[model samples]
Target: MAKVIVYPPTSMILYDLVERMGHKALVVSEAVRNLVTASGIESPPLNVTPEEPKKGLRYAAVDVPSGVRGRMALIGPIIEEAEAAIIVEDPGWLTGCSGCSRTNELVRLLIRTKGIPVLDLSYPTNDDEAKVFVQKIRTFLEGLK
Candidate 1:
């Protein structure tokens, strides 16, 4: 099965669709799961490990904002492992807020440069648009080997 990275990284709809199509959906929750469930975690106060910031440097420079670095650290590796991607642009705040615009842009850039097949879609505003959106996503996913 293809490893499909969904833009926004937190959209369950995209996650579900990818999984439903028999591919693995790479989303932020998986990273969060690793952070929280790891045995070395000390407390619930912080979500990040000391190594995260350092790992992030591979994707972003030290001078960049720590937030971007932290996010990239968690997401960059996922992007590297992606075989394809599905990006839903300008999704409503509730649907696609990754909370950092820089991170979002960087993530998209990384995915696009990965040389994988990418399906870009706009957020649907109406029932007809929504149906088309789903169809496009389904078609693109099914086309993957």
Candidate 2:
């Protein structure tokens, strides 16, 4: 099965669609789960471990915001591991809002330049468009080797 990274990373619908299509979805929630569940993380929020930003240096510069770096720490590796990707542009706030414009742009840049098969689709605004979105995703996933 292909390891497909979905943009925004927080979209459960994208995650479910990828899995339902017999592909592995590399998502942020799973990365966060790993961080919080990993031994020695004592932070109260448990959102970003101290070492996470350091790990992010591989993808971003030291001068970048810690938030972006921290996020990249989780997402960068997933992008590297992606065999394919599905990015829904202009996703609704409730659907796939990641809250970091810089990180979002960076993530899109990295994924697009990664040389893998990527399917870029617009967020569906109505029932008809939603049906087309799913069909497009299914077609793209099926095309992946």
User: 118 in model 2: Cα distance from truth in Å?
Assistant: 0.6
Candidate 2 per-residue C-alpha lDDT over 1-145 given as tens digits, one digit per residue, 9 for 90 to 100: 9999998788899999999999999998898788778786677565586788899999999999988998899899999999999998989778775679899999999999999999999998899999999999999999987
The segments of candidate 1 whose C-alpha lies over 4 angstroms from its true place after superposition are 43-46
User: What's the true lDDT of residue 107 in model 1?
Assistant: 96
Which clashing pairs does model 1 show?
none
All models: lDDT?
0.90, 0.90
Error of 1 at 129 (Å): 0.4
TM-score against truth, every candidate: 0.95, 0.95
Collision count for each candidate, in order: 0, 0
